[model samples]
Target: MVLPTLDKPVGQCLTNLRRPGGLGKDPERAQRRAEQLAAVDPDWNPGALGWTVDWQRHYTGLTLLLEGGAGLEEIVPGVTHRGDDIGRWLARQRRDWARLNTEQQHRLGEMGVKPVARPQKTATRTNTKTGATKGSDAFTRGVAALQQYIAREGTTVVSRSHVERLPDGTEHRTGVWAANQRARRDKLDAAQLSMLAALGLEWAA
Candidate 1:
């Protein structure tokens, strides 16, 4: 049985089949087909398992590595298989462990996966002369401004001329910054993009 990848037509077919008016329209046939697929691979429907197929694909790769006698320590970041970054996915799974459902956590536990420990935050030194905290980059400043804008306005729809002022008296051209970020999104890393998406930037997603 062929497993579905995120970009594959088979994956799209599976997604379509799970829609309300799709396979469920014919309960009997759907059950029969589901059973057939399950007989080959019980995890044929990862959505039902409370995760995305992209997640499942990377997980399957991890399991394959483990089955082939790879140690957990060997699965650090930068490890790749079939174009999927197994190590990065595993790290995310560990870092975002709280976001996983009970069953998902159980499944990962069965594979000896555990939550990663969060690093302790060090205190930042303030510029006493200027009365402002230092060391924030442009992107970091923009995200902070966007967050403040959302808190005040209840949305991320900033006008082209919108300006957001920070508590430290710094002004950020929020709208222009957002537009620039979206335009150069391809250069952003996954964590950076995820942060923007969490702040309600749909384009970042």
Candidate 2:
């Protein structure tokens, strides 16, 4: 059986459904519930709302009653729902809707409710370019080496070039030009830094 399509945007559809004596028939309560649900859902969409064919069949008689209220009596066709069956389905819908927290409910808002996309879980990152892996024995050793190096030679001291004057008063020899140069000369470079990072270790600047 062909189920009716809901071309109206979700928000509008919900607004209509939640109005007093409206389609869903729950009134102001429905709108407040819808808003609460939307606020909690980061990926909430204002489109795509409707009841499934199965639901329509299950609530066929009730749907007929509700459709009359909403002027949509002809949407579902040829489903014979008993009065007892309709009463049971309506009770279930009420119970289910009442149980919703709007914060915790995933997709049970109404028929045709689609779940918003959940953020993807990221895997532990590996940097092959620098050969860095967290919690590895190698990484741990690298951090230890860095700590030892730092302890032996405190913070990087800016090495000033030693200006030597020749017999003629001309500069003869000069020391390292920059502190970074001194660091490199002392064997502290990107390799050590990468290792420290991999082991989640922080070094004093």
TM-score, every prediction = 0.55, 0.18
Model 1 residue 151 CA deviation in Å: 28
For lDDT, the strongest prediction is 1
Q: Write the per-residue lDDT of candidate 1 for residues 1-205, one digit (tens) a residue.
A: 3444555577566666554554566779888888887897888776566555556677889999999999988998798888777886787778767656798799889999999887897765655523433323666788878876764444567887999899999788998988888888998887678667555466774
Give me candidate 2's TM-score against the actual structure: 0.18
Tens-place lDDT digits, model 2, residues 1-205: 2224856676555445433344344657756766776687622322222222223344445545555563222223332355334443333343334222353233334433233344576765556524434334443443343333232223222235543343344442222323333345345445444333222222411
Alpha-carbon lDDT, every model: 0.74, 0.38
- What lDDT is obtained when candidate 2 is compared to the true structure? 0.38
Clashing pairs in 2: none
Q: Total clashes, candidate 2?
A: 0
Error of model 1, residue 44, in angstroms: 1.1
Q: Residue 110 in candidate 2 has what lDDT? A: 41
